[model samples]
Structures are given as structure tokens and as C-alpha cells.
Target: MLPLQIGSFTPKAPVVLAPMAGVTNRAFRAMCRSYGDELVYVNEMVMSHAVVYRNDKTLTMMQFGDDESPRSLQIYGSDPDMLGRAVHQVCDEGRVDHVDLNFGCPAAKVTRKGGGAAVPAKPKLLQQIVRRAVQAAEPYGVPVTAKFRMGLWDDLRTDITTGRICADEGIGWIALHARTVEQHYSGEARWEAIGALKEAVTDIPVLGNGDIWEASDAVAMMAQTDCDGVVIGRGCLGRPWLFGDLITVLNGGEAPAPRRLGEVAEAMRRHARLLTDHYAGFGGEEHAMRDFRKHCAWYLSGYPVGPDVRRTLAQVSSLAQLDDVLGAFDPDAEIVEGGERIKRGHTNGPIKVALPEGYLDDPDELAIPDDADVMALSGG
Candidate 1:
């Protein structure tokens, strides 16, 4: 397998933990990193305004443990100036090793504001934002990367153009989730698009994302697309050990043994504890556990756990109650197969996509909006 590099750090394997909002926090990243070797874990997307203004919640999200080396931070914003300033802050602070620009989010709130996928449609804007962010990050010896979708929609295919622009702008790496904003994680991801993108950009590594539900799938993605690596998003939700599985498969080793209910509960508890500790200085354990309740369904997805038990766990008001509910699970129950790959979060059908007037008329328009023209959201 090919090794992955950003700046001075090189991971033996080319597997990355995709940054998921409300997930991929320090707690989750720590859990995943513990099971694998040489995997890059990214922080969830932080809005540029929030970061610059020091929004408590956003700043809290940026927290990384002392041992968390090669820290990867993903920042989202449509305004080039704000994004550039944000990159400078992250690099100037001297806390991060890599910075990833987010252009793949399909949230309507982001798209309605002419950000995220919408920015790519206007190649000039995309170029400006990337250029500014790269310039800001370069001085600190921090590598700048970008993650993007194939295009804003089926009618407007811009992945090739956007990928080329990012390459020309000196991006260290590019990750393509082979689905358009319109596709929105609906149909199967087009691996062919990844192959085409790899062919489009030669200097930097091209990572293929989406539909990598298992370790074998990662192997297949590489073999089929000849992409350099894979970025896993939903596949590792309930199964953080997936990193271990990916490492094993990449090395021609067997997948980790199946985990039982007791083991899964233990992992859930561990995740909660880490989150508590990570946020303890700010939110305390009660708030942290409250935030962690959302992950309960994901953790116990395919298990034979009853609805009542699941409901109770979901409604858990405190960590002690959560512990009690988790401890109530049958430790000896066999793990049900296929739960590992089920989709979680943002699975709803496509809504009407928003775009600027006559956006498709000119793909080359890269107008950088002034503060007055800035929209509230940039990506969806």
C-alpha cells in the first residue's frame, strides 16, 4: 500500500478518518487512533467566523490532546479573507500540523449561502479561497489540503475543474467524495469519478471516499481507481475498531475478531469518558454525557437489544444512568452481522438545491463576494 504524507508527517497506510460534524471529536478520534497504526484523524468542520470570533463551542471543538500529534484541522468558510485569516490563526497558533478545506458539505444551510459545493461551481472563488488559505498556511510549514464533492449537482459537473484548480493552487492533497451535492449520499458512489480525478491531478495524492463500508471495499477502491488512499466517514461510526480492521487488511492480516455486546458497551463507555475529559474543563461530564447520548443508537445498531432498552439508553440524562443502561445489556449476546455498514446521519432524500442566479451559465466565474454579498451558509 502507498504511504500518505502531509507536510513532514507520513503515515504508513493511506487511511484517513473523515471529519464528521457532531462526530470525529477528540474522543472519537482518540478511540479510533488507538486501534490502528498511522491513520490520520481530522477534527470536525469548524466555521471560519466561529473560529475567528472564538465561539466557545467552536473553540471547544478545536481542542486536541497533548499526545495528539500531527493534528489535522478542517475549516469551512466561503469568504476568502475570513478563510485565509482562519488558516493563519490555526498555523500561527502553532498547534496544527495539517489544515483541510471543506467544500463537500451538502447541508442546505451551507449551500443556500453560496458556500461549500456552490463555491466550486465558480472556479474563480474556489481558486481564491484555496490560494489564500494555502498562502496563510505555508508560512508555518503546515500542509493545506481540500475535500470536495464531484459537483454542485448532476447538471453542473465541476469536480474535474475544481480538482485541477486545487492542484494548480498548490494543495498538498485532494479527497473526492464521488457524489454530487444532488446525489447527497443516495445512490452508490461513482468510483469511476475517483479514477478520472486521479488521472486529472498527477502531483498530489488523490484519495477516494464514499461507500467504503468494509476493509475489503477499501482494497477494491484502490485497485479499481488507482487512487492513493481512502477516507472513511460513515463506515467507522459504531465501529471505531474499523481502523484496526483496515490496518490488518492492508497488511494482509485478518479482520479483528467480532465484538460482542459487552465489548461494544465498554467502547461506548470509553468514548463517553474521553469526551467528558476532553470537554471537562469547559462543559463538565454531565454536559458531555448529554452530548454523547446521540451515539447510543449508532453503537447498538444491529445488536439484539430491545426497543425499550434502546429508548432508555437514548433518553439517558446522566453518565451514571448511561452506565446503568449499558451495563444492563447482555454481555454474551453474539454480534449481528451487517450492522457495521448501515447508514447513519443525513440520510434524508434530496431537497431542492439552492444556487446563485445563472450559476450554470458560466462555470469559470469565480467571483469572491464582498461582506455584503456573503451568505449565511457555504456548504450543505
Candidate 2:
């Protein structure tokens, strides 16, 4: 596979970890990076206004490990000036190596104000946002990128248009989620849209997201769409080692065997510890353990760990409790057949796309939404 070059940085593999709020923090990133080298792991999405205002929680969320190379961050906002200022603030402080604008978030709180997926409906506004971000980061030699859905919905597609605008505004690259805002995280992603975007935007690299549950699925996306790389999101939810499989298969090697129950347990223990360390200044180990509770069911999804054990483990309040619960499992046991393909993360979608009143009335208008307070939302 060819390397994914954005500006002066080039990852060894054309693989990027999609930013997921509360999921792609430093600890989780370290876990995924441990399995593969030279991969781009983006921090969770942060609000531009929060960064500009220096919100403590937002700043804490932006922290990167000292060893993390080529730190990448994803920022979302509806106002061009706010987003631009946020980009400038981070770049000026040398806090990030790459900046990605988020335009695919379908959350009602975000889109109700002509932000997120709704922005693409107004091509002019989308252009301004991408251009502002690119211009802001250009002085610092940081490449600005973007990730967006197919469009507001099936009838209001804008992937190709979004790609062209990004390229014209000097974006490093663009990733298409291949699903409409209406589709949310449900249904199959249309790989054909990725190919169309790749074909339309030839100047910069294009990457594909959505439905990449395995290494082979990533391979299929690149082959079918000729996209430069693949962005792994929900696919790597609990299986950080999926990065290793992706690297191996992309490099023409066979996928590695799944880890046994014991190995999985060990990884979980390490994740819990890392999270505790991460939350030390914020909420301490207790708070960290609570955050990690959601991951318990994910880690044991396909394993025959029984409902009682799963329930108990999900409520673990401390590392010792985590260990005690995990130790009861059969270390040698393997995930059930086809367990690797089980779905994780948000599986519901195809909701009504919320937008400002008469938001779609003028696709060329350059107006921002009223009282949206998009900066309050965290992730898309």
C-alpha cells in the first residue's frame, strides 16, 4: 500500500483512526498504536469555541502522550471565524500537527443550527468554513483536512462538491463517510460515493470511512473506490488490535489470529490502568473506571462470559474490581465463530435530519444559524 502523505508527514500505512468522542482519548489511542506503527490516531473531536476559550475540560481532552508523533486533532464549529480562531490558537501553540474540520456530525444539537451535515447544503458556507480553517493553519505549515457525510440526505447529496471545495481551499485530504446524515450510523455505506468523490477530486488524496469492520473490508473500499486510505471508526471500538490486522492485510500478509480470552483480559487491564492515569488530574481512578465501564461489554461481546459476569464487569469501579471480574473468565477461551464481525458502537440511525427553519431555502446563502451554540457539542 502507498503511504498517506499529507503535507510533510507521511504515515507508513494509509490508515487513520477516526475521532470518536469519549472513545479516542490518549489511553485508547496508545492501545491502538501499540499494535501498529506509523498510524494516524486523531484525538476526539473538540469544539472550536471551547479551545478558543481555553475550557479546562476541552484542553484536557486535547492532551497527547509525549511519545505520540504527528499529533492529529479534529475540531468542529459552525462559525467560520470561531473555527478559524480555534485552528490558529492550536497551531500557534504547536499543539497539533494536523487539523481536521468535522462536517459530518448528524447530532440534532449540531445540525439544528445549520452546522454539521447541514453546512454542506449551503455550498458557499461550506467553502468558507474549509477555506478559513485551511488559511488559519497554512501559516504554521499544518495541513488542514475534513471529514463529512455523503450529504444532508439522499436527495441533497454534496460529497463531490465538498471534495472540490476542500481541494480548492488547499485541504490536505478529505474523508467521505459514504452515508447520509439521515442514515446516521445505520445501513450499509455506499462505497460508490467514495469512488465518485475520489474521481472528482484528483488533486488531493481522498479517504473512505464507514463499515470497515475488518482488514478485508478496508481493502475492498480502497480497491472499489481507489481511495488513498481508510479511516477506522466503530470497527476498532474494542479491538484496538484491528490496526495490526489492517496493517498486515494491507501489506499483503495474512490477518493474525484473534487473541484468546486471557490475552484480551490483559489488554483490558492495561486499558483500565492507562485510563486511570489519564483521568488522574480530572476525576482520579474512580472517575476513570466509570468511563471504562462502557468498554467492558464491548471487550466481551462475542465471548461466552455470561450475562451475570458481563453485568458485574460493566459496573467495575476500581482496577482491583476489574481484575477480580476478568479473572473468572476462561483465559483459553476464544471468541465465538464470527464474533469478530459483531457490530459495536452506535448501531441506530436514519433519523430525520434537523436543520434551521428554511435552512435549505437558499443553498447559496452565507448566513450562520441563530443561537445554535454549536461550540457546546463535543463530537459528531
Candidate 3:
């Protein structure tokens, strides 16, 4: 396989961890990075306004480990100016290596405000935002990339045009999820879109995302679309080690054998511990453990545990309680199959996506309404 170059940084492997809100925090990213080298891990999408205004949580989300390679950040905004400013801040800080714009989000709140998937419908605004972000990062030598869906709705196809514009603006890469905003996450991702995108742009790499549940799926995506790389999203939800599997397959080796329950439990403990350490200054282990409750199901989805066990695990408020509940599990149990591919987050029905009035009227210029400045409530 060919190496992926973004600015001066070249990743030996083309695999990347797609940024997902509430899931791709420092602890989770660190866990996944341990399984693969040269795999770029993106921070959760941060609202541009939040970044510019120094929202405490948003700033914290951008924090990366000192040894993290190719620190990547993803920003979401509908306005070109705010997005540009956020990119400039990232560049000026000299902390991040790559920046990815978010146009693939399908949350109702985000679409209602002319953001996320809605932004891509206005080709002009999309181009301006990409251009401004790239220009902002040019001086710092940070490569800028963008991720988008196939289009606003199933009936309104726009990803091909939007992708070409991104390439024209000198984006380092373009990631296509192969689903429209209307389709949301319900149906299958159209691999055909990725194949078409590769044909549309020749200079930059096109990373295909969506529906890659296993290491073999990555290989299949590459073969079917001829894409440069694959971005694993819902596929790696409960299994961060999927990255390890991806590396193995990409190098012509078979994927490592499935992880046993005991091994997975150990990983879960480590993830919880890391979360404690990350938020220790603010809330201590108890608070951090409380926050980790949300991931209990995702981490232990396919296990043979009963409802009583799961309830206890979910209600854990402290590290000690967490340990007790985890200890009750038979760690030696066989790892169950098919649990790795279960959707873990953001499974919602498709609703009418929101956009600024007349957003689609002129597809060639930025048309950010003042109301669009605020980040949508649901998308983040």
C-alpha cells in the first residue's frame, strides 16, 4: 500500500480513527493508538465558537498526550470566519499536526441550524470554509482535511461537487461517509460514492468511511472503491484493538484472533483508569468513573452478563464500585462474536435537515447567517 502524506507528515499506515463526539476523548484515543502505529486519531469534533471563546470543555477535548503522533483535531462550524479563526488558533498554538473539518454530522440540531451536513449543500460556503481553514493553517505547515456525507438529502446529491471543491482548495484529504443527511445512519453507506470520488480528484487522497466493521472490511473497502485509506467509525466502537487488526491485515498478515472476555475486561479497566487520570484535577476518580458509566454497555456489549450485572455496572459511581462490579464478571468467558459491529452511538431516525433560508440558492459563495454562528445542540 502507498503511504499517506498530509503536509510534511507521512503516515506509514492509511488507517484513521474517525472523530466521534463523547467517544473519542483522550483516554479512548490513547487506547486505540496503542494498537496501531502511524494511524492518525482525530479528536472529537469541537465547535468553532467554543474553541474561539475558550469553552473549558472544548479546550480540554483538544488536549493530547505528549507522545501522540500527528496530533489531529476536527472542527465544526457553518461560518467561514469562525472556522478560520479556530484553525488559526490551532496553528498558532503549534500543538496540532492535522485539522479536519466536519460536514458529515447528521444530528437534527446541527442540520436545523445550517451546519454539519447542511453546510455542504451550499457549495460556496463549503469551498470558502475549506479555503479559509487551509489558508489559516498554511503558515504553520499543518495540513487541513474535511469529512462530509454524500449530500444533504437522498434526493439532493452534492458530495461529488463538494469533494472536488475541497480538492481545488488544496485540502490534504477528503473523507466521504457515502450517506446523505436524509439517510442518516439507517441504511448502508454507498461505496460507489467513494469510487466516484477517487475518479473525480487525482491529486489528493480520498479516504472512504462508513460500514467498515472488521479488518477485512477495510481491505474490501479499498478494493471496491480504490480509496487511499479507510476511516473506521462505528466499527471500532467496543473494540479499540480493531486498529491492531487493521494493521495486521494491511500488512498481508491475518487479523489477530478475537479478544477474550478477560482481555476485554482488562482493557475496560484501563480505559476507566485513564479517564480518572484525565479528569482527576476537576472531579477525582469518582466523578471520572461516573462519566465512564456511559461506555459500560459499549465496552461490554456482547458479553454473556445478565441485566442485573449490567445495571450494577452502569450505576457505578466510584472506582471501587466499578472494580467490584467488573470483578463479578467471569473474565474467562469466551468472547462472543458479532458484538463488535453493533452500533454504539447516535442511532437516530432521519428527519428533515435544517439549513439557513435560501442556502441552496447560490451554491458558489459563503452564506452564513448570523444565527448559524452558534453550535447546534445535538450535533456535538
- Most accurate candidate by lDDT: 2
Better of 2 and 3 by lDDT: 2
Q: Write the per-residue lDDT of candidate 3 for residues 1-380, one digit (tens) a residue.
A: 33577666676568989988877878888889877767889988888889889888777778888888789999987789988999999889887899999887776666666767887777777788888899999999899988988887767988888888998998988899888887777778899999998898778889999899889999999999999998988777778899988988987999877777788788888888988877866676887878788788777877788999888887888777777777777878765677666776666656667765676777665547343444433342
- Candidate 2 structure lDDT: 0.87
**Which residue segments of model 2 deviate by more than 4 Å?**
1-3, 370-372, 375-378
Give per-model TM-scores: 0.94, 0.97, 0.94
- Tell me which of candidates 1 and 2 scores higher on lDDT: 2
Model 3 stretches astray by more than 4 angstroms: 370-380
Measured on C-alpha atoms, candidate 1 has an lDDT of 0.83
Q: Can you write out model 1's per-residue Cα lDDT over 96-129, one digit (the tens) per residue? A: 9999999887766666667777788888889999
**Model 1: per-residue Cα lDDT at residue 288:** 83
Compare the candidates by TM-score and give the number of the best one: 2
RMSD of 2: 1.4
Q: Tell me the tens digit of each residue's lDDT in model 2 across 11-83.
A: 8679999999888999999999999867899999998888989988888899899999889999988789988
